[model samples]
Target: MAGLLDIVDQAQAIACEDILKVDAFLNHQIDPELMQAIGAAFAQHFQNDQIDKILTVESSGIAPAVFTGLALHVPVVFARKLSGFYGENVKWLPFADMQNSWWISILITLVLMGLVSLLLALNGFFRK
Candidate 1:
């Protein structure tokens, strides 16, 4: 008699040591199915916008970065955690990597803002 939302809530609340345990496969191990789903979601979210590239900080971001790049069919670039003098044409972005996945986190708010601006600018060009 429960609705879908209730089921989802229950699922989220359920605690299981076995299920909660982080295995080498689920995350770092790289399950192809999960990666594909992630990629699909990323592609769907960005479908309206023309994304030329995907960027993230180096390290654990590599996995999601690869999925996003596959979804966009574009090259993926990761910023090195350590920066050097004379940073060339590089801009800063904030992202979050829990579990120490990546050394840096590109702020989600800024990413969305940048994507919106990029889309708007591109839309203007296509109309010409």
Candidate 2:
């Protein structure tokens, strides 16, 4: 498996202060070993936080998120991307499109509600 610094060296510079394109190992080629390392690193970083679940947006995040959940023995929940929300890494939000789409808001609400219900049911918070 490639080390963290080795993966950092593979990133493409985007003329940012601290941001570098990670599509080389994350999105485009999707080096699983690197993601596993990333998961382990995240698990180590947040182990003391007592996190019960891992939440992230879909696509490339799914890989590291799942691996991190595995390392931490927690459930991973990914938000579904609808339309222009698609991106490699999360840096900003598209407020204009969100303002225009009420259905998007409803869909997201429903998705969250469903996830909550599922979690509740799984944890026996919802008892018949």
Candidate 3:
């Protein structure tokens, strides 16, 4: 596994006196190899857990989350970020509404309930 500093060094950047931009690799255009390494590292840490799903925020997280999901042989569910523009209705339910605090609460509750249920099921399987 590459060290954190090594990864940082590999990152492309536009460094000014105090500011830096890593969009070329870290955010805007991702490096697949790095993402895979990241996913592998995360998977190694939680390998003991019976992970049924990989949940993450949209955009930047999708790539590594997908890699982790594949590593764990689980499904990936990313929360969508609402924008000013709303296109045609998609199939998946809206995971959150940033403008509405109540909606965020509901989403959190749902995610927690699902996780608890999954954990219980896994425990039962292990006990058998």
Candidate 4:
């Protein structure tokens, strides 16, 4: 998906020399076509695997996750980042100290990757 990088480079804005703001197309104002392309890429990469569900966080992840789910023909399970008044009412997985919003996404992604790896190992898909 060389076009994907071009879109990113063209739309992405650099802030404070480090932070990249992709609100125009990625996080905030989403481009459906780009999301579909991303989903197709993910589906192609993991086509051999048995993907029962696509796990992602709410808001930003929902779009791409939904597209990926459609491409993979699987359900999308989105995790809520914010807690309610009755924290007990919600099931929270204390995976990490979620201070930064970006870190929360990263942590969730890592957890999903680890879970996938574990499942693959258990299913003997990783056997050489």
Candidate 5:
């Protein structure tokens, strides 16, 4: 845990507040040692929770998921993208209709949700 914590301490939060960019270790450029440590730490933290499987997105998430699954003796599920990494038709359009005197917010939300669902299904289907 300390090793992972130390790595986290060294990593910086760039640009956005919610995003802690860890490209140097667990993301873009991977450090196997840190990832393994991370997996062990996660396993230790959730040892008594009775976890059966691990779910993670493709690319960056694979390393940590594999390590955690290894340490926990569980199966790891990878999210394989079909259309694209971020999915196709993934957008939000809050267009206003003057004639109808309304904003298409609900419609946009429904469309986005449907796109997300479709993407998930496709991703699951085209697992390689």
Candidate 6:
């Protein structure tokens, strides 16, 4: 029987007596090809933009971020869930977000910074 998951997945073809299973793909079973396709799509869409690095959260965002990083030929950075242990080189910039306002602002700021860095690097590369 179709339920919330069917709606979420935007399923078009499903029998009335059939039960759709997404846990095997989305939740439990991690499909490498599916992940790559997702990353490729994102990379293709953002290819026109100047992207220096890819950033995402922990766990779920890791695979997509890694794929995007590979496609874009750049590094990926993920914010930790809880602060416990990190290497010295791993920069820890405290996120200041009150009512999610600061979080959005910070994300935009980082994207812009990355864009500028990418542009500058490209310009320098061409200058040689």
Best by TM-score: 4
User: Candidate 1 lDDT, tens digit per residue, 1-128?
Assistant: 13323433544633564444223323446556555666778888999897887767676667767897898898887767555533354475233335542433335446865896698678873232
Question: Per-residue lDDT of 14-109 in model 6, one digit per residue for the tens?
Answer: 445576554444455555666677778789999998888776877777887888888888788786767654334556444433578667767877
Q: Report clash pairs, candidate 6.
A: none
Q: Model 2: residues >4 Å from true position, as ranges? A: 10-19, 84-128
lDDT of 5 by residue, 29-102 (tens): 78889888888989999999878778788888899999999999988988786775452574643343345424
What is the C-alpha lDDT profile of model 4 across 18-57, one tens digit per residue? 8877788877689999999989989999999978878787
Model 5 C-alpha RMSD vs. true structure (Å) is 6.8
Tens-digit per-residue lDDT, 29-128, candidate 3: 8878878888888888889987878878888889989988888778888878687424346554465444785677677779986896689678873242
Candidate 2 C-alpha error for residue 70, in Å = 0.5
Q: What's the distance in Å from true for residue 100, model 5?
A: 20
Across 44-109, the per-residue lDDT of candidate 2 in tens digits comes to 999898778887887888999999999999888887868654444666546535655667667877
Candidate 5 positional error at 30, Å: 1.1
The C-alpha RMSD of each candidate to the native structure, in angstroms, is 11.0, 7.8, 8.0, 7.6, 6.8, 9.7
lDDT, candidates in the order shown: 0.61, 0.78, 0.74, 0.80, 0.76, 0.67
Highest lDDT: give the candidate number: 4
The parts of candidate 4 lying over 4 Å away from their true place are 84-128
* lDDT: worst 10-residue window of model 3: 84-93
- TM-score, predicted candidate 3 vs. hidden true structure: 0.56
Kindly report which residue stretches of model 1 are placed more than 4 angstroms away from their true locations once superposed. Answer: 1-27, 83-128
